[model samples]
Target: MKKEQPSWWRPWVLPVLLVLGAIAVQELMRAQQPAPFSYSEFREAVAQGKVESVLLFPTRIDGHYKVGPGENPRTFSVVRVEDPALLEELTRHGVKVSGVVPDSPWMSIGMWLLPLGLLIFVNLARRGGSTEPGGYLAVGRSKARIYAEKDIPVRFSDVAGVDEAKEELSEVISFLQTPEKFRKLGGKIPKGVLLVGPPGTGKTLLARAVAGEAKVPFFSISGSEFVEMFVGVGAARVRDLFQQAQAQAPCIIFIDELDALGRARQAGPMPHEEREQTLNQLLVELDGFDPRIGVILMAATNRPEILDPALLRAGRFDRHVLVDRPDRGGRLAILKVHARSVPLEDPADLEALAGMTVGMVGADLANVLNEAALLAVRRNKDKVGRAELEEAVERAVAGLEKRHRVLNRLERERVAHHELGHALVGLALSGAESLRKVSIIPRGIAALGYTIQVPTEDRFLMTRQELMDRIAMLLGGRVAEELVFHEVSTGAQDDLLKATDIARSMVASYGMSESLGPVTFDDGKASPFLETGPSRVRGNYSEAIARRIDDEVRHLLEAQHARVRELLGAREAVLRKAAARLLEKETLSGEELAALVAEPGSGKPLEPPARDAA
Candidate 1:
């Protein structure tokens, strides 16, 4: 990342500007306040009887006087000369004299020191010698944002979803509140609790909740912030952070994205790099701090796999709390939490929405509600009702609606038939998600139409039959195009890509293909640290086995395509009827689709044959 210098000014600029402004103001005021005169001049004025009443002090004399008699008086002052009869001269001139002690040096010193202090302040400010942590010379000081107990506004209640994670960290919060509860039982509070999850899984929020509920100091900083341009800045920051935490004992130090600062130490970049030194110092501090002292160290990172072993060892981040994506109940809870801001109508049922959103995490859920409110506002509705919320979910999953993307009549009919094929095949699968919606409307880039399925429940693993049915469903669109128009369009491109990957997974990773001999052939991560992309991925099999794997994948796809062709061919009449109804409505739910394909006031329903492990 490049650093951008502030074009306007730095902190020292304001006070320096203030000093100059003060000097200007003082000069302007001096002209009006008083004009100084010499003692000889004062005597000459007194002799001329032009002197007004004089207020005499030990060091100076102040009075109002005119240059000649009967002239309007003006203010003047003069330092008292050690001349005799000065008072007598004023008295003889019929000018009343009053005595006063001079103003104290402390008051005058403030006037003299004002500009001097401003200069000194600007000098120190420029030198970056901030005595406070993160000051100029204090650049080594930690940049962690400190929040006193009362300063934290969010508590555990504010953090909904991830109940398991909250429960795990609550013990740490409880320990902080009453250390004796655990200390008496010979149980040491885990010195550090590492919150590991994907991005936006509420790791940082959970840590803040802990600090709030525990009523302790909270220091938050990002891992990348520790290192700086200076050689030992990172290490110094680490030391300073630990010292401050120790001082405010009963405090929580929450480091976000710890992996950036704690990447595995080996050979790379400059030797004894600043980040490594910072990590070393951090390790020392983690080991050095006694949990009994009330300082609890916590860190969050999505990529826990890349963290240093030293950082993950017993004394450091001993407790690894996994804050995974929320379950159905958790999502519902999260929805309720975010929904409080929007005045949801009675029809806005969150439970159904949560069920529809199977794999969405907390952040995604929050976005859903926010998007719902935005949609309601766009539509000029009084409150967010069921229709608005449903649209929000669809908008979040698919891209925002692009109804304005007008397609030609031929293209529109093709999209309708293609999407119907997917819906029909998906409905035929026993364990597949229930068909929820179908639309000929364009959404997102490249998606001319879409068929949405709402999962009945989350599934961790799929059976061979289920995977096979999924592949068949993926091939349904192309088969439908061939059956109807007798020629397939490029609309089946995404479906084909997904089907190939699934077939590959089934053959290579799942060991489900008979020709592959039920042996696993998947490779580990590409870099052994980061996620794998297509080109980066390597195969564990030999050339001969790779050929066999490719053949097996091709065979599976062909088999699924054959099954889809048979299924759609048998239901040709039903497919036409459904497509015609979809063309009339432009959008349809499962109920509507089922009604369109229902037996004509008679026996068994018209549909594709089911092929799934229920």
Candidate 2:
């Protein structure tokens, strides 16, 4: 850690010291001044003809009077009051009275300087005390944090899960380390490399690693920091940043969240002129910088679609490197990288854990490991075990277990049946995700029960049958509720929404609707990298086609619902037994659930109890 050097010139410190010194001098002068004499006493002295003389000013009267004939004259000051009769009495008593204006040069100077000094002090304090670039005067200066080569601890080995992105950046690192090699070949390195990916995918980390590997200075900044409320400030900052980067040749300049500064300029009445100016300056810098100078400009953003096309053109951000989420092997690699510091039990199944976390990125994997370590400590265990890791995964997916939320007997029974419905359907389906666990215990915000299904492996493609099976599995809970209780509850709200979305995507996006005939009606606005919520449907198709689309979606869901109802209806006896056992145990692993489903029960369906009798 760098020691913070003592600031010699703090803006507030000087003002404070000056004020304190002034107060001290004022106090010293007060102590040296003669005691105050009351106006009444002065009047009485005048009446007794003991007052020798008085000097009257606008504010106060300074005078001296003899205590006795031989005594020295004592000086005293009295605050002036409106006493017209006193002056006449002094005249009548034949006392000496002089009207003299007070003239203290220092007092006059202080009176003129005090308010001015106070205003200056307030302005200085508000502008900030330190000489850092965040002060009002330094707003135009770049806010980039400069890091020397040795200061960056991250290297290629420290980053994982984005191997392709790393591979792409390796060439940039080589160019930085040996620009002469590329220059000799009459080839120029890419002036800029844009790292595009979803959030938490280690885009920024990869940039740091590039600098670390090349052993060059690194300048890291966010694009939003370039733009300010002032119109031309952002443009000035862009120029200043480039100047600093050029000064430190063979350095890497990284800007995170480039979309903030480089969004496509919209044609409208109200344009963001400041942002446009800053972006134009950035473009100019990119064009002006020489590739052979080893000043590599790198940027990262999740929203690349919204970036200005000019900023992403050839010879600008010449190459675009995708830092996508890790697959199974990548996830395993990431888990290992994060697990280096965590002490794990010898038999901890990291492979299985990695498999369970299918779509997790590097940051999420690190969080999982951290959460596992925390769980181990919470359970008074020295080493993190598979159980702790598994629980952490559950917490990550479903949320923290709400063990204190007690369910009534009826609710518990309903939740048990609902979860088992999902597990049984998933297990029966050939292409469905493998059932992991089923629990009636409440977890998360509103989940009264949950059933976890882990894919056997990472799957990038799914057949139409697989998608249908997925839909069936989702609707199984509601079907199970109807079969057992003869009525469905709102517990399957999330499941229905998910099933409907999948069915709609299959029809509109995947073109699986038989009647729609492979014609895609999707607006294509959804980001491929992000797991965003369902998009609002744009009216790209006619009302007739829209009605057809809605009809197809309803038919698909109704078909899956009917299939699930039929499938669970025949297995009602097994469902009843499994639900009873789940109520007793509160939780069941995949193996236990499979065993329950395999066990042959009496070939009889349990009838719903009579509502009137109850």
Q: Evaluated with lDDT, which candidate comes out highest?
A: 2
Model 1 error, position 541 (Å): 3.3
Residues 59-139, model 2: lDDT tens digits: 898887867768776888999999878788989988888996567999888885886577675656556423355664677
| Strongest candidate by TM-score | 2
lDDT tens digits, residues 206-270, model 1?
99999999999999999999989889989988888888899899899999989889998889565
User: Compared to the true structure, candidate 1 yields what TM-score?
Assistant: 0.76
Candidate 2 error regions (>4 Å)? 1-107, 110-136, 602-614
For model 1, where is the 10-residue window of minimal lDDT? 527-536
In order of appearance, the predictions have TM-scores of 0.76, 0.80
Query: What is the Cα-based lDDT of residue 466 in candidate 2?
Result: 80
Model 1 ranges with Cα > 4 A deviation = 1-130, 268-272, 526-536, 599-614
Q: Which ten residues in a row have the lowest lDDT in candidate 2?
A: 605-614
- Candidate 1 has an lDDT of 0.83
